[model samples]
Target: MSDKNDSATVLPEVTFSTFVLSLASSALVHLGEVPNPETGNTSRNEALARNAIDVLTMLDDKTRNGLTPEESKLMRDVLYELRMKFVARS
Candidate 1:
């Protein structure tokens, strides 16, 4: 049936690596638009870091391909540092 064929035509599941990469790319692009409270300037770096944290939080062990435990820990640390900086600046 046409419906069956359409279902079969759907794209395959996305790998974790691909998903992460896509999320990272999108976050980087949006980072420039995030507003800074103090100077009223855009803080792209901070935004990117925050986005990364959000993405990581959504990732699970099965969805964290290509990232080792060390890398995950590093990302968390970086996110924490950025959040602190943002709070301090504000």
Candidate 2:
């Protein structure tokens, strides 16, 4: 069972939304917006950030018409936030 408090003992359940958020987290890390969980470092790598954004964009494109309304909205909102952050970083 996934436990929020005992993360070392269990991971979050796999789901489309979680997957998208995972990728977005990685993108944020690359953008130096969020610290790396393991290293406690924040570093920018625009190429990698753009790559993640592209992958998420592709996901949004490919998953269109297939996702629940909530899932779709999450994707759109995350992408929008990431893009705006990326622009500001640049």
What is the C-alpha local distance difference test score of each model? Answer: 0.55, 0.95
State the RMSD for candidate 2.
3.7
What TM-scores do the predictions have? 0.34, 0.89
Clashing pairs in 1: none
| lDDT tens per residue, model 1, 1-90 | 347758768764686445555555444434643444456666456555566657656664434575778666655554455446546543
Candidate 1 TM-score versus the reference: 0.34
Maximum-lDDT candidate: 2
Residue 48 miss distance in model 1 (angstroms)? 9.1
Please state every model's RMSD to the true fold in angstroms: 9.0, 3.7
